[model samples]
Target chain A: MKKIMNAPDAFVAESLEGLVRAHEGLVTFGAGRTFIRRRDLAPGKVAVISGGGAGHEPLHSGFVGRGMLDAACTGHVFTSPTPDQIVAAMDETDTGAGCLLVVKNYDGDVMNFEMAAEMAASRHAIDTVIVEDDAATGPSLRSRGRRGIAGTVVVEKILGAAAEQGSNLAALKTLGDDLNRRIRSMGVALRGTTVPENARETFSLGPDEMEIGVGIHGEPGLERTRFAGANEIIRLLGERILAEFPSDVAEGGTARPLLIVNGFGGTPPIELYLAQGIAHRFFENHGVVPARTLTGTFVTSLDMAGLSITLALLDEVQFKLWCAPVATPCLSW
Target chain B: MKKIMNAPDAFVAESLEGLVRAHEGLVTFGAGRTFIRRRDLAPGKVAVISGGGAGHEPLHSGFVGRGMLDAACTGHVFTSPTPDQIVAAMDETDTGAGCLLVVKNYDGDVMNFEMAAEMAASRHAIDTVIVEDDAATGPSLRSRGRRGIAGTVVVEKILGAAAEQGSNLAALKTLGDDLNRRIRSMGVALRGTTVPENARETFSLGPDEMEIGVGIHGEPGLERTRFAGANEIIRLLGERILAEFPSDVAEGGTARPLLIVNGFGGTPPIELYLAQGIAHRFFENHGVVPARTLTGTFVTSLDMAGLSITLALLDEVQFKLWCAPVATPCLSW
Candidate 1:
């Protein structure tokens, strides 16, 4: 790839500096350019924070705002943020309300956030919520569970909005748990992306093949299928997602769900919208009453050619909270 | 150029359905599949709306919410939305509040939205704000300016927030006009992205050459330079953007402008951050204190391999409103 940089090793630090400079109003850095919130925290408000490798643009930092995360810990590209970085962000944004750590269900991310949460709990009543949104990542009832993908943003936004509205840490944790159960996501990658530092491709794909239900870090998806239009692709993915929801939920007696169609980096908005269209039709065919839908590159792989669809069943309270105001780099209220 | 689609023609409708299915809480569509806001509009709010080609996700539709846009029109990939579609959205979202049409600097988008505004204004006090945010496009002093690119999003968000805060159509139009002066964006493309329907490349570039200051529709950038690292790329692009700002603006105490490092589709987050780092260092060296910075794929070129940088100089009011609450599919408040 034709990239401009002084040195490959210097990319992360320089990039973080650029992020801080660009979002100075909402983001800042501590020692070693570790990410932190720019605002002064009110005393006694629990600081909910999360972070991961730097490659995901809006993942940790993009989510730092009023109705979302208080701060994010950033690591190197496609690598987990260090425990020290997470601890720093927690210290910077922590209020007596105690901090909640929202982590993706990735092995590295889980281990790192888990260690940080344990450290925070040792210091205070810090709580944590690990989001396992990607159904493609893990077995339903086994080791580690699903890998967290784009759904982390929804979890953080929903929970962060609740926290901003002054929900107690315990209450927020309960809300997080409940919301987690109601959400599920799956992705497909048509092509691979490269990590600049490595200067090598992350994964390989046949010219005519797509790996459905792929992972964000370039892990293999559930199955390989011949390339198809977004409609067919989404139908297959939505059927799998709908299968996970309670049949009663699909029947829509009393519940409506929020849908997210997220692009895995190189996928364009045009393609995402097409995917959204197909998914919407699938829901209508299934007799589900949709509440709200989001389509875009919310969470992403580093220019991977793919997308993920995440569904969150929202009650009135969740809906209202989701609508609350927020200010961060990537998203607002 | 590997894609997972059955045919190009089915991309848009299928994608829209999938998006609604994925995000039923935030968006809804008419029987004909026109995307709209989930909430009903008040009778006296000026219905500000915009849309163009399908690649620019979250621009028209994502900006629809409280304190932002009322509704958006969608088009096929890189194509302007039909006038009928724009009219339909206006009728649904516009109450007594006169509608404001915010069109990018593109010839197609401008002509289409203008025609629709004229049609709507005959019945209502519809006004329009033409955004020439891409300084690289419509000549600053010429009748025809540069095509609006990613910077259009900033203009739309700021004006939309003002409208949500009860600004009338006239006031919102003025804000939009003022934003056009305060905003400037320039983009670069390393590679051209192919539309799924075409299944063929839209533009071509040498494997080692990068197009700087390129237009969104795959037009060549200001320069086709040898690809370098992030720092070098930032220097090349930053000089143009900084120079575009009048010496008085840069010299006069502006509130350090907001910086947007937008990807032209296929560029990876790592590369964007690397570019962002370079941009930040350039600003730091120049003593330009950026008030806010956003780095992501805002306006995209199908899957083009490049990124753009946008600077929006905000006055106090615009700054506060920029931080206001919003809810949309792609962008949150």
Candidate 2:
């Protein structure tokens, strides 16, 4: 587990500098930190901002651009960004129109971003949208508040596109709520990732085993499962997400859904695509038309060797917003 | 190594199906994979087409979309697409504006794409641009031509953006040639990635050691060296690339270049970003200003545990084009 970092502590700061240097045209920031807001922020448009730990490359920060998030706060690898940093990003990207804080369902993310959002709301008219789409871990009741996973990208993109299209703060919140109703995600990890500065594995998983319902922080999944083929894996995960679909979409069967085949960390695009093939066939066989799809590393769990699937059931307007141009690093469609 | 795949042979076809299904609005293909092109190809733009082995996730196909590649020919994992498939892509995407083929410097990629281009040239007046930017293996002038690595993205993006702006085939070739002169890439791998179906590692290095200047196919590199810190690694690779910079850009003591910190399959984005940080500091210390930077799994070697760096010396026009909008699945900036 050798790595090429200078020092464990300097890793985050140095990485941000490099990111800014590379994307100078689309990004700019205050001296001394990683919060780079989108270059062209309009005063009248509500801003969407999100961030978390640093390990998930292109997640919160890389997504800060047009038709996506307007600002991102980067924490240390696997650690939540401080509430102060989140507040800084909110302030930097905030125009008179207000801001939207999209927090993942993780305990750290929820607490930190919520605190920042509350702080912002006290100072300004900032809004918030919490995404909790993970369907893997649950007691299916009060404890079943879904953990945010790769599906956060779909939510952010939809909401961001709506925000870009002059959706007012109230309109944006309605769109965000609509996005929440239509989205569900689940993931499994075959292996754990090594933190570069640590020069060691973050968590341990049996080489021959995989865990379904895995979270991004290398959190233990609901259960350890035997390795299976792509089709079986998709069927197992899809069944859970499908069960969560709204009765109208499932019963009426008139609306089409957007599919997202998201790689966790180290899984190759080839494997993700294979999993996607299975998920697509299963969804199509269920008479649900997939109107739009995104396949790539949207939200990742460091280098966890697995993937997640997100199904965003869309209305006509949501479908149109989903197809809007996005200028993020990893996503553009 | 556990993988979520059905059969080794079925990986490519299944992945393609999943890709198109997921990106339903952006991509379309014929049955039996005869032709695959973006849904947004305009009326008379010069089609920019390129392809090789299937392992590179977004290279030939992930890049197919508006403002980027018009079409791409995909083959089996790490295998070149058949001539018939390449010819079909050319025919479908090529209008009277002609087409430009961007082939990597590998023997197989060059041979296969050249053959397809020749086949297309027999009927349509098509031009080709061969990129050879892996400076670690070149500079002897007599040795086998330089190996192409991550620099392919720069070339493809510039050519694709130029084509999107309605550049003719000849103009696109000129831009590609200029980029070839400016770009250089080198890769290091800690371990090799296994083929999906077989789960057999393609190339081998020691657990604690790394190979520099390796090709994408897990082929032997120009050197086998002990792993060092990111600064030292970037210094070594940067020195090699800087040696190849054109005198005009390198002369004014302002040789600002675009940086690409690429992951060779297994390397995580966290480690890649740390490495990019070190690489940036080293370049700045050496009197080089980095104009643009991208760090991710642009071209991969399955799940090989490694990273590659590409430095493309940027002129004014190149910098502007690099900052241009590129709407591709894997990369967008």
Candidate 3:
């Protein structure tokens, strides 16, 4: 693969080191560089921690700072972080209130973070919330349930704000579960990503083909279809996500949705914005009024040329929390 | 050829429309949607305007808001904005304090922006400053001088703050010129971008080759060398940029440079951060200390798979101005 990397094996560690160095004022590395935490942690506030593979950047790590995640445990590309790393993140960021672990719905990630929570329970109050907002997989087919995709960003943001506001561990856990139930995401990949160590693309497709409902780890998408226009692609993804919305959120009553049109790494901002325009129209035609819209590359699948649309049904309090200010390297408002 | 776009010809306009829609609170479109201006413009502050081809996103358009460019005119992908678009931007953003036009050094860009300045002069005071900080092309070889690349972002940030602080048209122009002279940039491309209209890659390279000193518009670099490690590649680009620094700035006596490691769309954050770490070490070995560093995809060449490094030699005044707070959609620091 043609990539700017010193050594394939050193990709994850070096990238984390660079992240710390680049945002020196905002974050620092824990002992052994297993985890990164904000420089200044508010005393007696619940610490929010989340992490997974290194490829989907600006996810767990980039969201670490004052208004978002307290710490993020990083792992190798498309690989889950070790339980020890997650434990270190928990230990480093725990102030006194407790720690909240935001784990995505991958088997490896769920197990690892759960193991870390069990390991750290004696020392501090620890809770793990599994985010299964990916609506790509059918509910009954997979034992692991829905895979977590870009909706993790929405979970982290709202939960981070709630944690910062002195919410207890139980309260944060409830909020996370509620938010995950309300959020739905689906992605379409135009190309697969090349892992640093592989030196080749993980998967291949025909020139005129595109993968719909693709997972973030370069997993096979639900369907491989001929490439279509931007609006058509967005409509398929949007309809799938909208159809999966909880009954209460799906009804066009008083619910206002927060839309996230996320690019999978390689897509440029122009395309993301174009997708957002199409998404706005899509929602409008469906008789839904989106309250807040976020369009950018928040979560990515390392150099994958694709985009995902996430719709999070927000209540008044949730909308306020979503609108709350955040100060992180990748996200600042 | 895989991309998320509707019609190739409608790409630029549709993208701009999405930008205005996404950041409706911060910006609005002109009468013909040729230009976008800040929603709230200070009555007496000098207006800062910049524009060029559409492919290099977040460069001229994303920087339009509170403390950055008052307006930005956009053109078709890799094509210069027409004089009419530039004139519309100038006319819409001009206040009693006059307007400052920041143009990158390109034959078409310079000619068109200059013509727009002439056309807008009768209605309001207008001044133009050309940015030519690309050190890849020698001064004597190209009639238009060094091509402007990522340094244009630096010029916009520094001058945007100065303009917001009530700097007049002449002062802003001088500051832009000084900042432009102090900045130097060079890039490398692993792959070329595919413009929507073309529906194919702009250029092609061998499997194990990379282009050094590549232009933002997918132009061939100064050399096509075998691919190397990240450190080696960064070292080469850094050395070339450092060697061409003005003697005064090169002395490194109390000069705190601002470093920008920009991605050309397709490069992921992991690779960009890895390159940043290597850049830091290269600067340390060369006895140069970068006071501030901004790393992300600030300037991009559509979906090109490569990156560019820009080092702006900043003095105390410029550094302070850089630190000043500004609220824009893409940049809010």
Candidate 4:
């Protein structure tokens, strides 16, 4: 493969090493050598830690800094972090207050983080908040509940802000869960992803086709539709997200929703801003004017040509929390 | 041809429209509609304006904010802005102190910017500092000299800070030229770029090969070689940059160099950070520890799969300028 990595097995460690080295003042490695923790933790503040696969970068890892995530545990490419890694993160950031795990809705992630919370319960009071805001999938007990995607970033930002204000672990968990319910994200892929270890692409598409609602792991989406113009494609994705979004804050002009136009690695910034424009206009016409729009490759799918749109309905409290300043490697606002 | 654009001919305008809409508080379009000027210009401060082809985004337009470029004139993709566009930027930003045009080392750009400065001479004082920091090129006068790449960001940043500090037009120009001389940048492409208007890739490589010293516009470079491990390839690129780098600051520990690992759009953030780690260790061995390493897709080639490393020997004066606060749409420090 043409990946710029030394070896497939060393991807996680090498990547983390580069990250910690590049951001020496903000983050550093923990005892386990996998998870990252803030170099200087806030005294008596609830530690908000999150982790998952390694490929979707700047998510859990890049968000570690002063006002965001206190620590982040990373696993192998597309693999969930082990319980030991989670507990280590808890130990690194937990002061006398407590620790909160911001887990995604993946089966492995949820289960592993749960075990880690139980394992660290004696040392630190622990709580769990699972982000399951991917509205592309239906919520049914039979199916693996709605898989968390880009909306996890919204949850983390709000929860991290709440925790930074000295909210207790249980309070932060409640905020995270409520914020997760108010956010929805959906992805569209013009091309599929490939694992660094594999020498071939995991999936391929026709010359003029895209996968709407594709998962971060190259999972199949709601449909493999024909390629369309930018406006049409954005409308399709936005409609799907809006359809399943809760009515309690559907036309959220009260506090004004936050919209994020995230690129999946390969898409250019020019296009992401274009997508943000289409999203803003479309939503404005639908009686929802976003208070803020973030456009970047904060969440990615390796180096694939794709993008995801996230809509977070913020109340007065959540809106204030969203406006809180964060100084991280990937995000600065 | 899978770009998220409505029409090929409308690429530049649509992209700029989206950019202006997304960052309404920071920048807006000028009279000619091809240039962008800051929303609230600092009174009596020297205005720094930069522009070139449109595709290398976040270069000119993204830097148009509070403490960066006062104005940015954009042209069609890979095409230089016309004299009219440059004149419009000059008139819009030059508030008695004077205007500085930061042009790249391209024939079309230099010619057009010179014409614009001459045309606007009677109205405002305009000086120019052309950046030619691409080390892959030889300094043969006949040969187009060196094409400016990611190092343009360094020039803009330093000059922008200098301008903000009330440096006169001539002083800012001198700083810009000196900063250009102190910096050297080289790019390696795992894959080539494609113009959206064109339906095919501009250049292609063998399955196991890469293009070292590739230009931002898919220009051929010094060598097309086999792809190697990250460490070895970083060494190759780093050595080339260091070799052509000046002897005055060859072992610059006194003022500490600033190293930038810039992505060519298509490379993921994880790989870029990995390259930064390699660059840091590699430069440390070479007796230079960078005062700061800003790694990101600051300047890009329309989502091409590649990256460039920029090394700048910053004297104490310039080091302070480099560390000055900057708040822009794409860059913040």
**Highest DockQ model number:** 3
| Reference interface contacts recovered per candidate | 0.74, 0.65, 0.68, 0.58
lDDT of 1: 0.75
Candidate 2: tens digits of C-alpha lDDT, residues B202-230 = 87777667787788888887788887767
Give the Å error, residue A85, model 3: 0.8
Candidate 3 ranges with C-alpha deviation above 4 Å: A252-254, B252-254
lDDT of each: 0.75, 0.78, 0.87, 0.86
Better of 2 and 3 by TM-score: 3
lDDT of 2 by residue, A1-333 (tens): 665566778877776666666566766664247576888887788889888887777687778788988888888888888888888887777787888888887778888988887877776677778787777754364353777778788888888899899998888887887677678888888888777556677567776678887888878787887887788888888888888766776565537688888887687776777787788888888776677667767677667788888888888888888888887655665
Which stretch of 10 consecutive residues in model 4 chain A shows the poorest summed lDDT? A247-256
Weakest 10 consecutive residues of candidate 1 chain A by summed lDDT:
A245-254
- lDDT per residue, candidate 4, A1-333, as tens digits? 577778888776887888889889988999969699888999999998999998888788999987789999988888899999999888878887888888889999998999998899899988888888887886863276798899888888888888888888778877887887789999899887788866567579887999898888778888999998889988998898888776776754446689899888888887888788888888888777888878888888788888999988888899888889887878767
lDDT of 1 at B17: 56
Q: What are the chain B TM-scores of all models? A: 0.94, 0.94, 0.98, 0.97
DockQ of every candidate structure: 0.48, 0.54, 0.78, 0.73
Q: Taking the candidates one at a time, how many backbone clashes does each contain? A: 55, 5, 1, 0
Which is the winner by lDDT between candidate 2 and candidate 4? 4
Q: Is candidate 1 or candidate 3 better by lDDT?
A: 3
User: Tens digits of per-residue lDDT for model 1 on A1-333?
Assistant: 555456777866766666666666666776566776746565677788888876676677767766787888877778998888888887777767788888887788889888877777677677778888776655654487777788888889989888878899899889888777677888989987777678888788887788998888777788998877666787878878877655554455536677777878787765777666667667767766567777666687777888888887777898788767877766764
Interface RMSD of each: 2.8, 2.1, 0.9, 1.1
Better of 2 and 4 by DockQ: 4
When 2 and 3 are scored with DockQ, the better candidate is: 3
